[model samples]
Target: MIQRLNVNTEVLSTYIRNSNTPIEYLRQKLPNIDKFLKGELEPTFNQVYALSKLINIPTGLLLLKEPISASSLNVDFRTFNSELLSDISSELKDTIIEMQEKQEFLKEIVENECPFVGIFTFDDDYSDVILKAKELLGNEITRKRFDNYRKILGQLGIFIFLNGKYKDNTHRPLNLNEFRGFVLSDKKAPIIFINQLDSKTGQFFTLIHEFVHLLYGDSDLFDGEDSKKRSKTEAIINSITAEILVPKELISDMFDNQIDIRTSLDSLSRKFEVSKFVILRRLYDLSMLSRKDFMSLQNELEAEFKLIENIKKNSGGGNYHNNLLFRMDSNFFNHVNNAVQQNKITYTDAFGIVGVGYKGYKILSRGG
Candidate 1:
């Protein structure tokens, strides 16, 4: 059965502008859309069809008596080095695909439950609190320990999934920091596509930072460039994430705020169980040190804190995702298991539907 609705052209125009459509993408499909929007022309079937394609929505839904704003939108882009990923092993590709599918699933759930909306809701003070907490954990924690923390957090509703994987092409050198994470606007789960080759520490920090983004209800990509031009919300989230990882009271108790940069860095690093670089970042967030101090400390730790090499060959098995999915309590896994066992979906089709590869299917089946 098919259904249709007639959406007002004026309301639709408002929706388009508010949503931040790049002019080029808009112009490519509906050249006359501009004219129709400018004037008060009633939208035609063609216009509705064009909009349906652009928004990835059903055509008839456009005719609803009231216009509804999408809480989230999916945007896909290849890594800066998409061509390079071709030579990467198939297992890596499979992992990335699985991560992406799971992220999309989580996003669908979050866009609806967003509690806070707007800029002022996130402030610098809120962020400092998170940083202070992280500091208290101290430097004794290993990457494995942090992973366990993340798993526990996931149980509490922090969703992280892969966004994309990166690799070097024949022309370009491989970028070890290949994966990029994104926070969706509605406080749903954030996305994290890891470099199958990077170290556990960098991945852990990214998971924590991206989780902070989710808490703040944002949807933006972190380019990790320019410290000064950050949006207020971003600044707050960064602050909060730092605090959550290495809290303020703990740092204050361990070292004087006015201590020498290197001494403080080492002490804070040891105390928080985080890298010295992260500790330095936390200090900057606290406003206890000048920008120059932060930069100097950053440079000092650059060599030691440089991202580790990626695993190109057999990275063997490390499935944070598998562990997550196989844990019977996960909603997606539970739903998938029930559907398959009840014969709602054939085993072959179930594998295709969930986008899990053969090995994943076998593992999931065993878990069930």
Candidate 2:
């Protein structure tokens, strides 16, 4: 005789409604799903397990007396429309839950080494924050290439993750048009997530922007675009990021009365290792470019960048292993691997922490 398991009908129904999974799809899998939801029938263990797996919810939650409230992190979703906010919020909730779990596990075995994460408050001067970031990251960061920014941030105990798709569905990539980066406010295990779909220069700016958020102990999502519509905090952070990346003194020193706009932009872009858009923004800020010229140049640069992106997409993806390792920053990966090696966590547990299967773990272990 098959034993029927009593589960929280409300919780099950809520999970299905919130998830991307359609009710019809679940009905196809469980023919009696309608009855189960209506409280006419209790779900068997297998049915509960399948439902849990499908919705990416834990089976233990299904047995609770009531459905857990949909609590979200304190994130300022700047410029995100109401319709898309729910989807992105759900995605962010899942990511943060996974990160928090990993952080908790690592905290048990590792000491709190990062002391700088929560040192600053929103009341602190933005200049002071910039100076602190420069001191911690070092002057070499200014001279080095853009990718080195991630390495420097990691050294300062910031965990960075890059992913283009949501955890529940890899086929649907994150919309970079909506948001480019995310930050979580935590003294220990502060995290920054960059959408890999964004351009390299855009990602670089986002890294700094999110780092600023971490310093102020604020969690937020940003589109990384300059706009008059931005909030005061967003405006301040954007200005600070630009100043840190391209100092006003540097711009003044580089400006030549004889140089053309194109020549100046090229020189500044190469020197700063930033996109033309950033260089143009700085130029406009310094009044080196007229409002008319800035708008025209920005439109031209955006079109050119879009063409390059399209070409890259058509060329197929680069190395999978490299991308995987990059998405899971080496610092975080090493910690997981060390935990596995030290027997603090089994390989199976490590796989779950790193979000990979046994086979994928094997490849990652080999420096993939």
The TM-scores, one per candidate, come to 0.53, 0.74
How high is the lDDT of residue 102 in model 2? 52
- Per-residue accuracy of model 1 over 1-368 as CA lDDT, tens digit each: 11222346656665566557765787788776676656544554445546655865444334433454332221221232121121333333334334444444344334344332222234445644454334433334454555566565555455444322322122332345333334433344444344423345454565666566555454443233233434444545555556666767777567676667788888766655566767777767667778987777677677554432233343554464564353222445545566568764466544543555677666655663
lDDT computed for candidate 2: 0.70
How good is model 2 by TM-score? Answer: 0.74
- lDDT of residue 2 for candidate 1: 18
Q: 100 in model 2: Cα distance from truth in Å?
A: 3.6
lDDT of 1: 0.49
Alpha carbon lDDT of each predicted model: 0.49, 0.70
Model 1: residues with Cα > 4 Å off, grouped in runs:
1-120, 123-145, 162-179, 185-197, 221-232, 256-267, 284-294, 306-331
Error of 2 at 294 (Å): 1.5
| Residues forming the 10-long window of minimal summed lDDT in candidate 1 | 77-86
- Model 2 C-alpha lDDT per residue in residues 85-181, reported as the tens digit of each score: 4334455545545655455444444456677776787678878988887887666535555567787888777888888765425665677666777
